[model samples]
Target: MARIQTEHGGRNVQVDEYKGKKIEVATGYDARSDRWPVHVYIDGQKVSGQASADNMSEAFDYGFALAQREIEQQ
Candidate 1:
């Protein structure tokens, strides 16, 4: 398992790789917000992209999709 620890929206968020894949197994949040921020990384390189929404679930869904797209592109 691999993990990337980064801060977003003043909150600490960690994206962990599961089964040795680029897909983030889980997203962590330590702050309160209707929207959650995501820190994306591809092949150990951090990707510059902002994904957020008023809904935390939607935000995470978008982030996960973005991550998957990035991984496929690489």
Candidate 2:
């Protein structure tokens, strides 16, 4: 597993990839509310695009869980 970090506003957020399976983790901002957003993807497919958690760990976990659920469903 490799840990990837995406930086925004000079703050780096760590996102873990499972065996480098093309999982991408990125952050965005909600312009309307000025809130930070965390987005996760798998194989270039979006797993979750939501705003949650103040820390990277929880945000990444949410994305990872989403990926797991998607895999189980398929």
Could you tell me every candidate's TM-score relative to the true structure? Answer: 0.49, 0.53
RMSD of each: 5.5, 3.6
* lDDT scores of the candidates, listed in order: 0.56, 0.60
* Stretches > 4 Å off in candidate 1: 1-20, 25-35
lDDT of 1 at 35: 53
RMSD (CA, Å), candidate 2 to true, equals: 3.6
Using TM-score as the measure, the top candidate is 2
lDDT of 2 by residue, 1-74 (tens): 46567675534345555644566666544466554466766777877445565555666666566666665666
Number of colliding residue pairs in each model: 0, 0
Give the top-scoring candidate (lDDT): 2
TM-score of 2: 0.53
lDDT for each residue of candidate 1 in 4-55, tens digit (9 for 90 to 100) = 6454444545565633555442234435664556655555667686655655
Per-residue lDDT of 62 in model 2: 62
